[model samples]
Target: MIEPSPVKKEPIGKLISCVYRTQLKRMSRSLGEYGIGGGGQYSFLKAILMTPGTTQDQLTVKLKFDKATTARSVKQLEAAGYIKRSADPEDRRSHRLYPTPKAVEFQPVLQALLDESNARLTRDLTPEEEDQLIVLLQKLNLED
Candidate 1:
């Protein structure tokens, strides 16, 4: 009797998409208590905290997000009292983002949660494997 054809392997893009969706869900749940919306909200907060007074336009480029996304995130963060936006001195139309005292106090907890999440993601991988995976993943240039 002929053997049945082996199941086709899932593409790398499909696997990455699945992992991305799961990661988003996990992050959303993890951050929900703090009123921090997911879909890279933590990333925006961290960047602003690290580099206070960065404008939304700069964040858009640095984070590889579009203007609308950056604007929405900034608005949500501001609404959550995690950040405040000031008019840019050099540009009337631009706003400089700054993390609020609330964000500062929560930074440690935020970092700890992020660290735990990352550790969980790579728990099964050896340190060497994790390092190698990072190197390989970084090689994938998805930029235009």
Candidate 2:
């Protein structure tokens, strides 16, 4: 009979992708109640809230999202009353983004939801482990 091969360790990219997909599912479910779409929509909203008058191009770069994605998220947010866009005076082609009053009022709730999501993600890890993971992830981020 032929002997079976030993199982190799999972690739780092596969593990990260799995975790990311799970996180997105959980976040999407929580954000649905607030009419926020899944897959980086909340991230865009948070950025706009934190920095008003930011242009789409700026967000595309800052958030590491494609220009098409930035445009779609901005459109959805505007339709949902979470943000507003105005033409830039110096650049007619560019539009600056601002959070609407609705989004401003909802900011605290959004933050609380994000906090809960993060807490759930790290529930299995000790404080030291979580800290170490964060450090490692930051190091990985530096590669980009």
* Worst 10 contiguous positions by lDDT, candidate 1: 1-10
Using Cα atoms with residue i matched to residue i, what is each candidate's TM-score against the true structure?
0.90, 0.90
Q: Write the per-residue lDDT of candidate 2 for residues 28-108, one digit (tens) a residue.
A: 899998899986899999999999999999998898888899999999999999999999999999999999999999999
User: What tens-digit string does per-residue lDDT give for candidate 1 at 6-67?
Assistant: 98878889989887788878888999999999778988999999999999889999999888
Scored by CA lDDT, what does every candidate get?
A: 0.91, 0.90
Candidate 1: residue 73 lDDT (0-100): 91
